[model samples]
Target: MNNLFLRNQLCVPVKGYNRAIIYDILRKDYFLIPKEHCAILDTNDFIQFDKIEDVEEREELIDFLVNEEIIFQLSTSEQKKHFKSLNRNFENPNPLTNVIIHSNIDFRFLDLIKDQYLLNLSIISQEIDDNLLAILQKVSELEIDSIYLYIENSNIEKLDEYKKLFANYSLIFSVNFFNSKKIIDKTQLSQNIYYNFFEEEFSTYKRTLSIDKLAINAEHFLEAYNFHSYYFAKVYIDENGNIKNGLNNLENFGCIKSLTSSQFKEIISSSNFKELGTIKKKETLVCCDCEYRYMCVDSRVPSKGKKHWFHQFECVYNPYLSKWSNEEGYLNLEESGVYISASGCTIDQEKLSENFDKIWNT
Candidate 1:
């Protein structure tokens, strides 16, 4: 057999307590293998099948990787001259990619951003009214890629209205109805819309991270590698037209109505406003060690300290233990020796090392 090479599209195995993950950026999927495989991936030298002592076991692993298209066989001579690697840099054409509206207001402010392409336009309001419909119609005329509408106290009659609206505005990707008093036939609802009756009302509250929210594609992987997953190119306008980077941010740039197009651009382009977007997860205290950092769209806005940024809220998933809060024998941040405070988090490195050895039986 020739020298085996891991595919460039497959990221190097990231080790966790229980397992290591090899993310296939092109396929938008992942493979979990024994964490010990991390050692195999650490070397830049080629893996020769003939040199292995555990022939049968190593062969089996190689066979599986080949079958899964995660690796390929190439001549050692060709590897030196012809091997290509993925470009890790990422850039987007649009200055603004996402917009969130907490409540409907004078949408004339949209004209400033009308020329810029938007990836997602989210409209969240407490009730559906003429004002909301007017804003929706105005937004429908724009070139937004997708629209997600969230309304509280929705009903069957509103469902029919939504059907008609969706028929007209093909860009309305999904409409989430929250705290509906009456449950309508879900079958009647279109594929894009959903009614969340039992769940809590919609709020811009920070949520815990989960595996489901992870985006496992090349675009997301590249973006997360270069910038903050949530705040990059994102703009949020609250009910009173106050503009901010995100829902939980304390800084208010300005009211949308007061700022001209040039003024708005100046505000967003300023270093202070753009500072948060530049803080990638790799710079965060606890998240830097996480295997899922590149794929995670963690909403909690981390606070920046002199040396590093830290998450104020607790995350549900523990990367050290490879366990979720819902899972059995899960360890929290404190239990794992991560102490979070207003300024930043402090890691009890000795205790963390001890826990790692205990959990993995190393």
Candidate 2:
């Protein structure tokens, strides 16, 4: 879609760098559009075509943005010529950054740039209908990446149908699973699992799998399995090495640990092992002391925060301070059902580095 249409589609303020960094670590993939390229344009900054009676005034705003390097501007004649050329090749990736269109109305402007840019069409979940279908069809015809489907609990069934219909396309489904228990359970599969360790009610579960337990489990899982991709959503860690949530929060941690340990021992004992080359240690080191710290094949320290040395922020949900700040040190324990850390210890770089060395040698 054109810039104007995308500008109007934003429902909430974009979570820029923080979101980008977390996803990069979790997915082990780099962002196509770097975080530096993102910008939030306020309403006042918008160029309202309706307000500018004179053509020059309207053109001025467009020129300003192009000069500031915020967006690229093309002459009307040039845009028409480019649109014509777009149809010549459909397989080539469009280099234009994505634009999120907020409006519900039929956006004819989107058709003009569909082949030239990544158009993110956001429609209210409940309001989707035949009109929406037609718009999506036009997008599909252009062979764009895919349409992002945003849905709420009320429209989840419709989402399921949509998923089936566009199964062949590269569709990314975005939804808030916190409130939709039924939908969450329905989507569960062998490869996809969810655990609610952050909730206060699961405090006991949290205590059982302290950082040491979590690290051991992760090592076990990795050594035992040969899998392609692994996905974990909404995970967090705290001081005292306590684990909070994610797949590791599955029931029967004791059994899983026991089984994993036995298997690992068997494999090692049976093998004729040889020592790998060792490298020199550095004077200064950075580390992550999180519960899943060992299991995390991908991990990095946050630039800010006390635990900046050892802990990485893995959770997608905004950290709730009041809940995390509670003296009880458990998330979702009582009413809110959130997970909070008990020790609230920041990262100690030296300790983290030392632990890493110990784990590697063992």
| Collision count for each candidate, in order | 0, 22
lDDT of 1 at 357: 73
Report the C-alpha lDDT of model 2 over 183-202, residue by residue, as the tens digit: 43434322122211122222
lDDT of 1 by residue, 77-188 (tens): 5554576566678978666798888656777778877777888998887776777778878887688888877776566465676676666667777676766545654323
Q: Which stretch of 10 consecutive residues in model 1 shows the poorest summed lDDT?
A: 191-200
The TM-score leader among the candidates is 1
Candidate 2, position 88, lDDT: 13
- The candidate maximizing lDDT is 1
Report how far residue 252 has shifted in candidate 1, in Å. Answer: 0.7
**RMSD of model 1, in Å?**
3.7
Give stretches of model 1 more than 4 Å off.
8-12, 15-19, 42-53, 79-83, 156-161, 179-198, 204-206, 341-362
Whole-model Cα lDDT of every candidate shown, in order? 0.74, 0.30
The alpha-carbon RMSD values of the candidates against the true structure, listed in the order shown, are 3.7, 25.4
